[model samples]
Target: MSGAVQAGYAPPTGPDQPTSGRRWVRWLVAATVLWAVLLAVLTWFSIRDDPPTVREQRSLAEAGPVTDRAVGELLAAAGDGGAARLLPDVLRTGCRITPMEDGAALTRGVEVLLPGDDARGLLQRVADRLPASWRAGVETTGDGPVLRADAGEFVAVEGHATGADRVRFTAATGCRPVGDGYRPLAGGGGPETDQATALLRAWGGPAGQVDHVAAACPGGATARTARAESAPAADRPSLADALAAARGGAVGVRATPEVYAWRAAGTSVVAERVDDRIRVTVTTGCDA
Candidate 1:
Protein backbone atom coordinates (compact mmCIF):
# COMPACT_ATOMS: atom_id res chain seq x y z
CA MET A 1 0.00 0.00 0.00
CA SER A 2 1.28 3.42 -0.98
CA GLY A 3 2.06 5.66 1.99
CA ALA A 4 0.60 8.71 0.15
CA VAL A 5 -3.03 8.25 -0.99
CA GLN A 6 -3.89 9.80 -4.41
CA ALA A 7 -6.62 12.48 -4.18
CA GLY A 8 -9.16 12.00 -7.07
CA TYR A 9 -10.33 15.25 -8.67
CA ALA A 10 -13.27 15.01 -11.14
CA PRO A 11 -12.89 16.92 -14.44
CA PRO A 12 -15.32 19.80 -15.03
CA THR A 13 -18.31 18.31 -16.94
CA GLY A 14 -19.98 21.48 -18.27
CA PRO A 15 -23.69 21.45 -17.78
CA ASP A 16 -24.44 17.87 -16.83
CA GLN A 17 -28.11 18.84 -17.30
CA PRO A 18 -27.61 20.72 -20.58
CA THR A 19 -31.18 20.08 -21.70
CA SER A 20 -32.64 21.42 -18.49
CA GLY A 21 -30.38 24.44 -18.63
CA ARG A 22 -31.38 25.16 -22.25
CA ARG A 23 -35.08 24.81 -21.42
CA TRP A 24 -34.76 27.26 -18.58
CA VAL A 25 -32.92 29.72 -20.80
CA ARG A 26 -35.64 29.39 -23.44
CA TRP A 27 -38.37 29.97 -20.87
CA LEU A 28 -36.58 33.01 -19.54
CA VAL A 29 -36.30 34.49 -23.04
CA ALA A 30 -39.94 33.72 -23.83
CA ALA A 31 -41.07 35.31 -20.58
CA THR A 32 -39.05 38.41 -21.37
CA VAL A 33 -40.69 38.77 -24.82
CA LEU A 34 -44.20 38.25 -23.41
CA TRP A 35 -43.52 40.88 -20.81
CA ALA A 36 -42.31 43.34 -23.43
CA VAL A 37 -45.45 42.99 -25.55
CA LEU A 38 -47.72 43.26 -22.54
CA LEU A 39 -45.83 46.30 -21.36
CA ALA A 40 -46.20 47.99 -24.74
CA VAL A 41 -49.95 47.52 -24.84
CA LEU A 42 -50.36 48.83 -21.31
CA THR A 43 -48.16 51.80 -22.02
CA TRP A 44 -50.19 52.77 -25.12
CA PHE A 45 -53.41 53.02 -23.19
CA SER A 46 -51.94 54.61 -20.10
CA ILE A 47 -50.25 57.49 -21.90
CA ARG A 48 -52.60 58.65 -24.64
CA ASP A 49 -50.27 61.60 -25.44
CA ASP A 50 -53.30 63.78 -25.97
CA PRO A 51 -54.19 66.84 -23.88
CA PRO A 52 -51.91 66.99 -20.85
CA THR A 53 -54.56 66.61 -18.15
CA VAL A 54 -54.60 70.44 -18.19
CA ARG A 55 -53.33 70.50 -14.59
CA GLU A 56 -55.60 73.52 -14.38
CA GLN A 57 -56.72 73.44 -10.80
CA ARG A 58 -59.60 75.88 -10.56
CA SER A 59 -60.24 77.43 -7.12
CA LEU A 60 -63.85 76.56 -6.51
CA ALA A 61 -65.99 77.14 -3.43
CA GLU A 62 -67.07 73.56 -2.74
CA ALA A 63 -68.64 72.27 -5.91
CA GLY A 64 -66.47 69.93 -7.99
CA PRO A 65 -66.86 70.78 -11.70
CA VAL A 66 -69.33 73.00 -13.50
CA THR A 67 -69.74 75.67 -16.25
CA ASP A 68 -71.55 78.58 -14.67
CA ARG A 69 -68.78 78.66 -12.09
CA ALA A 70 -66.34 79.86 -14.70
CA VAL A 71 -68.82 82.33 -16.15
CA GLY A 72 -69.50 83.83 -12.77
CA GLU A 73 -65.86 84.17 -11.82
CA LEU A 74 -64.92 85.46 -15.21
CA LEU A 75 -67.71 87.97 -15.09
CA ALA A 76 -67.12 88.77 -11.46
CA ALA A 77 -63.44 89.42 -11.94
CA ALA A 78 -63.44 90.69 -15.51
CA GLY A 79 -66.44 92.90 -14.86
CA ASP A 80 -69.60 91.50 -16.41
CA GLY A 81 -69.66 89.80 -19.85
CA GLY A 82 -65.91 89.49 -19.47
CA ALA A 83 -65.41 85.81 -18.73
CA ALA A 84 -69.08 85.10 -19.41
CA ARG A 85 -68.14 84.55 -23.05
CA LEU A 86 -65.42 82.10 -22.02
CA LEU A 87 -67.95 79.71 -20.48
CA PRO A 88 -67.55 76.95 -23.09
CA ASP A 89 -63.84 77.43 -23.38
CA VAL A 90 -62.94 77.24 -19.71
CA LEU A 91 -65.56 74.60 -18.93
CA ARG A 92 -65.40 72.33 -21.96
CA THR A 93 -62.69 73.00 -24.56
CA GLY A 94 -59.77 73.53 -22.18
CA CYS A 95 -57.10 76.23 -22.41
CA ARG A 96 -54.60 77.13 -25.09
CA ILE A 97 -52.34 79.98 -26.32
CA THR A 98 -53.42 82.01 -29.31
CA PRO A 99 -53.49 85.36 -31.11
CA MET A 100 -55.12 88.56 -29.86
CA GLU A 101 -58.75 89.58 -30.30
CA ASP A 102 -60.13 93.04 -29.74
CA GLY A 103 -61.16 92.48 -26.13
CA ALA A 104 -60.48 88.80 -25.32
CA ALA A 105 -57.67 86.40 -25.88
CA LEU A 106 -57.54 84.44 -29.12
CA THR A 107 -55.42 81.55 -28.00
CA ARG A 108 -55.61 78.06 -29.46
CA GLY A 109 -57.35 75.21 -27.61
CA VAL A 110 -57.26 77.48 -24.56
CA GLU A 111 -60.32 77.33 -22.39
CA VAL A 112 -59.61 79.50 -19.35
CA LEU A 113 -57.04 81.31 -17.28
CA LEU A 114 -56.64 82.92 -13.89
CA PRO A 115 -57.08 86.65 -13.63
CA GLY A 116 -53.38 86.68 -14.43
CA ASP A 117 -53.83 85.03 -17.85
CA ASP A 118 -56.46 87.55 -18.88
CA ALA A 119 -54.40 89.11 -21.66
CA ARG A 120 -56.19 90.10 -24.83
CA GLY A 121 -54.74 87.14 -26.72
CA LEU A 122 -55.36 84.80 -23.81
CA LEU A 123 -58.96 85.83 -23.30
CA GLN A 124 -59.49 85.62 -27.04
CA ARG A 125 -58.18 82.09 -27.04
CA VAL A 126 -60.48 81.20 -24.19
CA ALA A 127 -63.49 82.79 -25.79
CA ASP A 128 -62.67 81.03 -29.06
CA ARG A 129 -61.93 77.53 -27.75
CA LEU A 130 -65.25 76.54 -26.25
CA PRO A 131 -67.76 73.72 -26.59
CA ALA A 132 -70.81 74.73 -28.61
CA SER A 133 -72.97 72.51 -26.45
CA TRP A 134 -73.87 74.68 -23.44
CA ARG A 135 -72.03 77.71 -24.85
CA ALA A 136 -73.79 81.05 -25.12
CA GLY A 137 -76.57 79.96 -22.79
CA VAL A 138 -78.30 77.70 -25.29
CA GLU A 139 -80.64 76.57 -22.54
CA THR A 140 -82.46 79.89 -22.77
CA THR A 141 -83.30 79.18 -26.40
CA GLY A 142 -86.93 78.10 -26.77
CA ASP A 143 -85.96 75.09 -28.92
CA GLY A 144 -82.59 73.59 -28.13
CA PRO A 145 -80.83 70.82 -26.29
CA VAL A 146 -82.00 70.88 -22.67
CA LEU A 147 -79.51 68.79 -20.75
CA ARG A 148 -80.68 67.18 -17.49
CA ALA A 149 -77.43 66.62 -15.65
CA ASP A 150 -78.34 67.38 -12.08
CA ALA A 151 -81.22 69.73 -12.82
CA GLY A 152 -81.65 70.32 -9.08
CA GLU A 153 -79.84 73.67 -9.19
CA PHE A 154 -82.35 75.08 -11.65
CA VAL A 155 -85.39 75.19 -9.37
CA ALA A 156 -86.86 78.59 -8.55
CA VAL A 157 -88.99 80.47 -6.05
CA GLU A 158 -91.96 82.75 -6.94
CA GLY A 159 -93.76 79.83 -8.64
CA HIS A 160 -90.72 78.76 -10.70
CA ALA A 161 -91.84 80.83 -13.64
CA THR A 162 -90.65 83.91 -15.43
CA GLY A 163 -94.15 85.34 -15.22
CA ALA A 164 -97.80 84.31 -14.86
CA ASP A 165 -97.77 83.28 -18.53
CA ARG A 166 -94.20 82.07 -19.04
CA VAL A 167 -92.59 79.52 -16.74
CA ARG A 168 -88.83 79.25 -16.16
CA PHE A 169 -86.22 78.81 -13.51
CA THR A 170 -83.26 80.86 -12.36
CA ALA A 171 -79.66 79.69 -12.51
CA ALA A 172 -77.79 80.76 -9.39
CA THR A 173 -74.48 79.86 -7.81
CA GLY A 174 -71.86 80.66 -5.14
CA CYS A 175 -68.08 80.80 -5.42
CA ARG A 176 -64.78 81.69 -3.75
CA PRO A 177 -61.37 82.62 -5.06
CA VAL A 178 -58.78 79.96 -4.42
CA GLY A 179 -56.01 77.98 -6.08
CA ASP A 180 -55.10 79.63 -9.38
CA GLY A 181 -58.78 80.43 -9.93
CA TYR A 182 -62.19 79.99 -8.36
CA ARG A 183 -63.83 76.71 -7.48
CA PRO A 184 -66.88 75.55 -9.36
CA LEU A 185 -69.70 77.31 -7.52
CA ALA A 186 -72.17 75.23 -5.64
CA GLY A 187 -75.14 74.09 -7.72
CA GLY A 188 -78.57 75.53 -6.78
CA GLY A 189 -81.34 78.04 -7.30
CA GLY A 190 -80.34 79.95 -4.19
CA PRO A 191 -79.64 78.77 -0.66
CA GLU A 192 -82.13 81.31 0.69
CA THR A 193 -84.82 80.22 -1.79
CA ASP A 194 -84.86 76.70 -0.38
CA GLN A 195 -86.26 75.68 -3.74
CA ALA A 196 -85.79 72.04 -2.88
CA THR A 197 -88.03 72.37 0.17
CA ALA A 198 -90.53 74.33 -1.90
CA LEU A 199 -90.53 71.80 -4.74
CA LEU A 200 -90.72 68.75 -2.49
CA ARG A 201 -93.87 70.41 -1.21
CA ALA A 202 -95.28 70.57 -4.77
CA TRP A 203 -94.84 66.79 -5.17
CA GLY A 204 -96.42 65.44 -8.40
CA GLY A 205 -98.38 68.26 -9.97
CA PRO A 206 -99.14 66.42 -13.20
CA ALA A 207 -97.12 68.28 -15.85
CA GLY A 208 -98.77 71.50 -17.05
CA GLN A 209 -100.58 71.83 -13.72
CA VAL A 210 -98.61 75.01 -13.16
CA ASP A 211 -97.78 77.33 -16.05
CA HIS A 212 -95.43 79.91 -14.49
CA VAL A 213 -91.91 80.14 -13.13
CA ALA A 214 -89.63 82.66 -11.46
CA ALA A 215 -86.17 82.80 -9.96
CA ALA A 216 -85.18 82.94 -6.34
CA CYS A 217 -84.10 86.52 -7.10
CA PRO A 218 -87.55 87.75 -5.98
CA GLY A 219 -87.85 90.56 -8.46
CA GLY A 220 -84.23 91.31 -7.71
CA ALA A 221 -85.33 93.02 -4.52
CA THR A 222 -82.99 91.28 -2.14
CA ALA A 223 -80.22 91.80 -4.63
CA ARG A 224 -77.51 91.35 -2.05
CA THR A 225 -79.32 88.58 -0.19
CA ALA A 226 -80.14 86.81 -3.44
CA ARG A 227 -76.49 87.01 -4.42
CA ALA A 228 -75.74 85.33 -1.14
CA GLU A 229 -77.81 82.30 -2.23
CA SER A 230 -76.80 81.12 -5.67
CA ALA A 231 -73.21 80.04 -6.27
CA PRO A 232 -70.99 80.59 -9.27
CA ALA A 233 -71.30 77.76 -11.82
CA ALA A 234 -67.89 77.07 -13.42
CA ASP A 235 -64.95 78.96 -11.98
CA ARG A 236 -62.45 80.47 -14.43
CA PRO A 237 -60.44 83.58 -13.73
CA SER A 238 -60.16 85.86 -16.72
CA LEU A 239 -57.48 88.32 -15.63
CA ALA A 240 -55.10 87.64 -12.81
CA ASP A 241 -55.38 91.30 -11.97
CA ALA A 242 -59.13 90.98 -11.67
CA LEU A 243 -58.88 87.86 -9.51
CA ALA A 244 -56.42 89.65 -7.26
CA ALA A 245 -58.82 92.53 -7.15
CA ALA A 246 -61.67 90.25 -6.18
CA ARG A 247 -59.58 88.67 -3.48
CA GLY A 248 -58.83 92.18 -2.29
CA GLY A 249 -62.44 93.17 -2.87
CA ALA A 250 -61.18 95.21 -5.80
CA VAL A 251 -62.67 92.83 -8.36
CA GLY A 252 -65.11 90.66 -6.35
CA VAL A 253 -65.31 89.17 -2.91
CA ARG A 254 -67.82 86.45 -2.17
CA ALA A 255 -67.76 83.62 0.38
CA THR A 256 -69.93 80.52 0.55
CA PRO A 257 -70.70 77.50 2.74
CA GLU A 258 -68.96 74.16 2.73
CA VAL A 259 -72.08 72.15 1.88
CA TYR A 260 -75.44 73.52 0.91
CA ALA A 261 -77.92 71.79 3.30
CA TRP A 262 -80.33 70.83 0.51
CA ARG A 263 -77.57 69.03 -1.40
CA ALA A 264 -76.84 66.62 1.46
CA ALA A 265 -80.20 64.84 0.97
CA GLY A 266 -79.22 63.66 -2.55
CA THR A 267 -82.34 65.32 -3.91
CA SER A 268 -81.15 67.35 -6.86
CA VAL A 269 -84.60 68.62 -7.66
CA VAL A 270 -87.89 68.39 -5.81
CA ALA A 271 -91.46 69.47 -6.62
CA GLU A 272 -93.55 70.96 -3.89
CA ARG A 273 -96.12 73.54 -2.82
CA VAL A 274 -96.16 75.65 0.35
CA ASP A 275 -99.33 77.49 1.30
CA ASP A 276 -100.30 79.69 -1.70
CA ARG A 277 -96.73 79.62 -3.00
CA ILE A 278 -95.58 77.03 -5.54
CA ARG A 279 -91.84 76.39 -5.51
CA VAL A 280 -89.27 73.90 -6.68
CA THR A 281 -86.19 73.01 -4.73
CA VAL A 282 -82.87 72.66 -6.47
CA THR A 283 -79.32 72.08 -5.38
CA THR A 284 -77.90 75.59 -5.03
CA GLY A 285 -75.00 77.70 -3.81
CA CYS A 286 -74.69 80.85 -1.73
CA ASP A 287 -72.41 83.62 -2.90
CA ALA A 288 -69.84 83.90 -0.18
Candidate 2:
Protein backbone atom coordinates (compact mmCIF):
# COMPACT_ATOMS: atom_id res chain seq x y z
CA MET A 1 0.00 0.00 0.00
CA SER A 2 2.72 2.67 -0.33
CA GLY A 3 0.29 5.45 -1.07
CA ALA A 4 2.96 7.73 -2.51
CA VAL A 5 2.50 5.75 -5.86
CA GLN A 6 5.59 3.64 -5.75
CA ALA A 7 5.57 3.45 -9.53
CA GLY A 8 5.85 -0.15 -10.70
CA TYR A 9 9.17 -0.26 -12.61
CA ALA A 10 8.62 -0.53 -16.33
CA PRO A 11 11.17 -2.68 -18.17
CA PRO A 12 13.33 -0.84 -20.68
CA THR A 13 12.20 -1.60 -24.16
CA GLY A 14 14.21 -1.73 -27.49
CA PRO A 15 13.32 -2.80 -31.09
CA ASP A 16 11.19 -5.95 -31.21
CA GLN A 17 13.25 -9.15 -31.39
CA PRO A 18 12.20 -12.11 -33.52
CA THR A 19 11.78 -15.58 -32.00
CA SER A 20 14.64 -18.10 -32.61
CA GLY A 21 12.44 -20.17 -34.91
CA ARG A 22 11.61 -17.14 -37.08
CA ARG A 23 15.30 -16.22 -37.41
CA TRP A 24 16.13 -19.79 -38.44
CA VAL A 25 13.40 -19.77 -41.10
CA ARG A 26 14.70 -16.53 -42.66
CA TRP A 27 18.30 -17.85 -42.82
CA LEU A 28 17.18 -21.13 -44.31
CA VAL A 29 15.21 -19.42 -47.11
CA ALA A 30 18.17 -17.22 -48.06
CA ALA A 31 20.57 -20.21 -48.13
CA THR A 32 18.18 -22.23 -50.23
CA VAL A 33 17.88 -19.45 -52.82
CA LEU A 34 21.67 -19.06 -53.03
CA TRP A 35 22.16 -22.83 -53.55
CA ALA A 36 19.60 -22.84 -56.39
CA VAL A 37 21.41 -20.04 -58.20
CA LEU A 38 24.79 -21.78 -57.90
CA LEU A 39 23.41 -25.04 -59.23
CA ALA A 40 21.89 -23.29 -62.24
CA VAL A 41 25.19 -21.63 -63.14
CA LEU A 42 27.13 -24.91 -62.95
CA THR A 43 24.62 -26.72 -65.13
CA TRP A 44 24.85 -24.03 -67.81
CA PHE A 45 28.64 -24.26 -67.95
CA SER A 46 28.60 -28.05 -68.23
CA ILE A 47 26.10 -28.05 -71.08
CA ARG A 48 28.02 -25.40 -73.00
CA ASP A 49 31.37 -27.18 -72.78
CA ASP A 50 30.42 -30.77 -73.65
CA PRO A 51 28.82 -32.27 -76.73
CA PRO A 52 25.24 -33.45 -76.28
CA THR A 53 25.89 -36.85 -77.81
CA VAL A 54 28.18 -38.85 -80.05
CA ARG A 55 26.12 -38.37 -83.20
CA GLU A 56 26.59 -34.63 -82.91
CA GLN A 57 30.36 -34.93 -83.27
CA ARG A 58 30.48 -35.38 -87.04
CA SER A 59 28.12 -34.22 -89.70
CA LEU A 60 27.64 -35.91 -93.05
CA ALA A 61 30.60 -34.07 -94.56
CA GLU A 62 33.05 -35.23 -91.93
CA ALA A 63 31.67 -38.77 -92.06
CA GLY A 64 32.77 -39.32 -95.67
CA PRO A 65 36.47 -39.50 -94.86
CA VAL A 66 35.77 -41.89 -92.01
CA THR A 67 33.79 -44.16 -94.31
CA ASP A 68 36.46 -44.02 -96.98
CA ARG A 69 39.08 -45.04 -94.50
CA ALA A 70 36.93 -47.95 -93.42
CA VAL A 71 36.52 -49.08 -97.02
CA GLY A 72 40.25 -48.95 -97.57
CA GLU A 73 40.84 -51.08 -94.52
CA LEU A 74 38.30 -53.65 -95.69
CA LEU A 75 39.81 -53.86 -99.15
CA ALA A 76 43.25 -54.43 -97.68
CA ALA A 77 41.97 -57.22 -95.47
CA ALA A 78 40.43 -58.95 -98.48
CA GLY A 79 43.92 -59.33 -99.99
CA ASP A 80 45.05 -58.55 -103.53
CA GLY A 81 43.47 -61.56 -105.18
CA GLY A 82 39.92 -60.68 -104.07
CA ALA A 83 38.13 -58.87 -106.88
CA ALA A 84 36.45 -55.88 -105.23
CA ARG A 85 34.32 -52.99 -106.39
CA LEU A 86 32.58 -50.06 -104.71
CA LEU A 87 28.85 -50.48 -104.42
CA PRO A 88 27.06 -48.51 -107.11
CA ASP A 89 24.41 -47.29 -104.67
CA VAL A 90 27.02 -45.27 -102.77
CA LEU A 91 27.01 -42.83 -105.70
CA ARG A 92 23.32 -42.07 -105.20
CA THR A 93 22.40 -38.84 -103.44
CA GLY A 94 19.36 -40.16 -101.59
CA CYS A 95 21.15 -42.88 -99.69
CA ARG A 96 19.60 -43.47 -96.28
CA ILE A 97 21.60 -43.31 -93.11
CA THR A 98 19.09 -45.35 -91.14
CA PRO A 99 16.16 -47.45 -92.12
CA MET A 100 14.16 -46.72 -88.99
CA GLU A 101 14.22 -42.93 -89.32
CA ASP A 102 14.43 -40.29 -91.99
CA GLY A 103 17.91 -38.75 -91.96
CA ALA A 104 21.04 -38.61 -94.03
CA ALA A 105 23.74 -41.21 -93.55
CA LEU A 106 27.11 -41.94 -95.18
CA THR A 107 27.94 -45.43 -96.44
CA ARG A 108 31.00 -46.61 -98.32
CA GLY A 109 31.10 -50.26 -99.22
CA VAL A 110 32.86 -52.81 -101.42
CA GLU A 111 31.66 -56.07 -102.88
CA VAL A 112 34.44 -58.63 -103.15
CA LEU A 113 34.10 -61.56 -105.51
CA LEU A 114 35.90 -64.54 -104.03
CA PRO A 115 35.48 -67.95 -105.55
CA GLY A 116 34.64 -70.35 -102.70
CA ASP A 117 31.91 -72.77 -101.71
CA ASP A 118 32.13 -71.97 -97.98
CA ALA A 119 30.93 -68.40 -97.59
CA ARG A 120 31.29 -68.45 -93.83
CA GLY A 121 34.90 -69.54 -94.07
CA LEU A 122 35.65 -66.62 -96.32
CA LEU A 123 34.19 -64.17 -93.80
CA GLN A 124 36.27 -65.68 -91.01
CA ARG A 125 39.40 -65.31 -93.10
CA VAL A 126 38.67 -61.66 -93.82
CA ALA A 127 37.89 -61.01 -90.18
CA ASP A 128 41.14 -62.58 -89.11
CA ARG A 129 43.06 -60.42 -91.53
CA LEU A 130 41.65 -57.19 -90.05
CA PRO A 131 43.49 -55.23 -87.39
CA ALA A 132 43.23 -56.61 -83.89
CA SER A 133 42.02 -53.26 -82.67
CA TRP A 134 38.95 -53.64 -84.85
CA ARG A 135 37.79 -56.62 -82.73
CA ALA A 136 36.43 -58.18 -85.85
CA GLY A 137 34.38 -61.30 -85.39
CA VAL A 138 32.08 -63.44 -87.43
CA GLU A 139 28.71 -64.59 -86.05
CA THR A 140 26.08 -66.87 -87.42
CA THR A 141 22.77 -65.20 -88.13
CA GLY A 142 19.50 -66.41 -89.65
CA ASP A 143 20.62 -65.28 -93.10
CA GLY A 144 24.20 -66.51 -92.89
CA PRO A 145 27.46 -65.57 -91.26
CA VAL A 146 27.91 -61.85 -90.55
CA LEU A 147 31.03 -59.93 -89.65
CA ARG A 148 30.72 -56.97 -87.28
CA ALA A 149 33.31 -54.64 -85.84
CA ASP A 150 33.99 -51.07 -84.88
CA ALA A 151 36.02 -49.12 -87.43
CA GLY A 152 37.06 -46.47 -84.92
CA GLU A 153 35.58 -42.98 -84.57
CA PHE A 154 32.00 -44.23 -84.37
CA VAL A 155 32.02 -45.93 -87.75
CA ALA A 156 30.31 -49.35 -87.69
CA VAL A 157 31.42 -52.02 -90.11
CA GLU A 158 29.36 -54.98 -91.27
CA GLY A 159 30.00 -57.70 -93.78
CA HIS A 160 27.88 -60.58 -95.02
CA ALA A 161 27.97 -63.10 -97.80
CA THR A 162 26.04 -62.03 -100.88
CA GLY A 163 26.46 -65.55 -102.23
CA ALA A 164 28.96 -68.36 -102.33
CA ASP A 165 31.07 -66.28 -104.70
CA ARG A 166 30.55 -62.74 -103.37
CA VAL A 167 30.80 -60.92 -100.04
CA ARG A 168 29.60 -57.39 -99.35
CA PHE A 169 31.18 -55.20 -96.72
CA THR A 170 29.87 -51.82 -95.66
CA ALA A 171 31.03 -49.03 -93.36
CA ALA A 172 28.22 -46.74 -92.30
CA THR A 173 27.33 -43.87 -90.02
CA GLY A 174 24.03 -44.09 -88.27
CA CYS A 175 21.35 -41.47 -88.84
CA ARG A 176 22.72 -37.93 -88.70
CA PRO A 177 21.72 -34.43 -89.63
CA VAL A 178 22.78 -33.64 -93.15
CA GLY A 179 25.31 -30.82 -93.03
CA ASP A 180 26.63 -29.56 -96.41
CA GLY A 181 25.89 -33.01 -97.90
CA TYR A 182 28.50 -35.29 -99.46
CA ARG A 183 30.66 -34.59 -102.50
CA PRO A 184 31.90 -37.52 -104.55
CA LEU A 185 35.48 -37.57 -105.74
CA ALA A 186 35.89 -35.98 -109.14
CA GLY A 187 38.37 -37.38 -111.66
CA GLY A 188 38.76 -38.53 -115.22
CA GLY A 189 38.54 -42.15 -116.31
CA GLY A 190 41.55 -44.43 -116.00
CA PRO A 191 42.35 -47.77 -117.65
CA GLU A 192 39.42 -49.32 -115.83
CA THR A 193 37.11 -47.00 -117.70
CA ASP A 194 38.33 -48.33 -121.04
CA GLN A 195 37.86 -51.88 -119.88
CA ALA A 196 34.33 -51.18 -118.69
CA THR A 197 33.38 -49.59 -122.01
CA ALA A 198 34.87 -52.43 -123.98
CA LEU A 199 33.05 -55.01 -121.95
CA LEU A 200 29.74 -53.19 -122.39
CA ARG A 201 30.22 -52.94 -126.11
CA ALA A 202 31.19 -56.58 -126.34
CA TRP A 203 28.05 -57.50 -124.40
CA GLY A 204 26.00 -55.48 -126.92
CA GLY A 205 24.87 -53.06 -124.23
CA PRO A 206 24.92 -49.29 -124.11
CA ALA A 207 27.65 -47.43 -122.28
CA GLY A 208 26.93 -46.62 -118.62
CA GLN A 209 27.77 -43.68 -116.43
CA VAL A 210 31.14 -43.81 -114.77
CA ASP A 211 31.84 -42.59 -111.23
CA HIS A 212 34.99 -42.52 -109.14
CA VAL A 213 35.92 -42.80 -105.44
CA ALA A 214 39.37 -42.32 -104.02
CA ALA A 215 40.98 -42.85 -100.65
CA ALA A 216 44.23 -41.61 -99.17
CA CYS A 217 46.68 -44.47 -98.86
CA PRO A 218 49.74 -44.79 -96.70
CA GLY A 219 52.98 -42.99 -97.66
CA GLY A 220 51.12 -40.01 -99.10
CA ALA A 221 49.76 -42.03 -102.00
CA THR A 222 46.12 -42.15 -103.08
CA ALA A 223 44.17 -45.16 -104.24
CA ARG A 224 41.56 -44.32 -106.85
CA THR A 225 38.81 -46.59 -108.17
CA ALA A 226 36.72 -46.09 -111.30
CA ARG A 227 33.33 -47.83 -111.65
CA ALA A 228 30.89 -48.13 -114.55
CA GLU A 229 27.73 -50.20 -115.09
CA SER A 230 26.28 -51.16 -118.45
CA ALA A 231 22.67 -50.40 -119.30
CA PRO A 232 20.23 -53.27 -119.27
CA ALA A 233 20.24 -55.02 -122.60
CA ALA A 234 17.89 -57.86 -123.46
CA ASP A 235 19.77 -58.82 -126.60
CA ARG A 236 23.14 -58.94 -124.84
CA PRO A 237 25.67 -61.63 -125.72
CA SER A 238 26.50 -64.52 -123.37
CA LEU A 239 28.12 -63.04 -120.24
CA ALA A 240 30.85 -65.71 -120.10
CA ASP A 241 31.83 -65.37 -123.78
CA ALA A 242 31.73 -61.56 -123.63
CA LEU A 243 33.78 -61.47 -120.42
CA ALA A 244 36.27 -63.92 -121.88
CA ALA A 245 36.63 -61.89 -125.06
CA ALA A 246 36.98 -58.62 -123.13
CA ARG A 247 39.54 -60.14 -120.77
CA GLY A 248 41.62 -61.69 -123.57
CA GLY A 249 40.18 -65.20 -123.05
CA ALA A 250 41.08 -65.32 -119.37
CA VAL A 251 38.96 -67.66 -117.26
CA GLY A 252 36.85 -65.89 -114.67
CA VAL A 253 37.26 -66.44 -110.94
CA ARG A 254 33.49 -66.93 -110.78
CA ALA A 255 31.58 -67.97 -113.88
CA THR A 256 27.92 -68.85 -113.50
CA PRO A 257 24.71 -67.94 -115.29
CA GLU A 258 24.00 -65.27 -112.65
CA VAL A 259 27.45 -63.79 -112.16
CA TYR A 260 30.83 -63.64 -113.90
CA ALA A 261 33.85 -62.06 -112.21
CA TRP A 262 37.52 -61.82 -113.02
CA ARG A 263 40.58 -59.70 -112.28
CA ALA A 264 43.14 -58.56 -114.81
CA ALA A 265 45.80 -55.82 -114.93
CA GLY A 266 45.00 -54.53 -111.44
CA THR A 267 41.31 -54.19 -112.19
CA SER A 268 38.21 -56.25 -111.26
CA VAL A 269 35.33 -56.94 -113.58
CA VAL A 270 31.94 -58.27 -112.42
CA ALA A 271 28.82 -58.89 -114.46
CA GLU A 272 25.68 -59.76 -112.47
CA ARG A 273 22.32 -60.61 -113.90
CA VAL A 274 20.02 -58.22 -112.08
CA ASP A 275 16.35 -58.67 -112.92
CA ASP A 276 17.11 -59.92 -116.42
CA ARG A 277 19.65 -57.12 -117.02
CA ILE A 278 23.34 -57.74 -117.11
CA ARG A 279 24.83 -55.13 -114.79
CA VAL A 280 28.50 -54.91 -115.53
CA THR A 281 30.83 -53.21 -113.03
CA VAL A 282 34.52 -52.60 -113.55
CA THR A 283 36.66 -51.37 -110.66
CA THR A 284 40.39 -50.66 -110.50
CA GLY A 285 42.98 -49.84 -107.82
CA CYS A 286 42.34 -52.80 -105.54
CA ASP A 287 46.08 -53.28 -104.99
CA ALA A 288 46.69 -49.60 -104.50
TM-score of candidate 1 relative to the true fold = 0.22
lDDT of 2 at 83: 72
| Candidate 2 lDDT, 1-288, residue by residue in tens | 654634796554445955678789999999999999999999898778965457645677777677777777777677554677776335334545556544576778877888666667768887998779889999989998999998776779999988767789998876665677766554346666676777777777767786666654433344566656666566666788777766675546788877888776556778777875666676655464
lDDT of each: 0.27, 0.71
For candidate 1, write residues 79-170 as lDDT tens digits.
Answer: 22111111112221222322331111111010111223223333333233333332322132354222221212221111012221222222
Query: Which stretches of candidate 2 lie above 4 Å from their native place?
Result: 1-53, 89-103, 218-221, 249-251
TM-score for each candidate, following the candidate numbering = 0.22, 0.74
Clashing pairs in 2: none
In lDDT terms, which candidate is top? Answer: 2
Clashes of each: 73, 0
> Candidate 2 lDDT (Cα, whole model)?
0.71
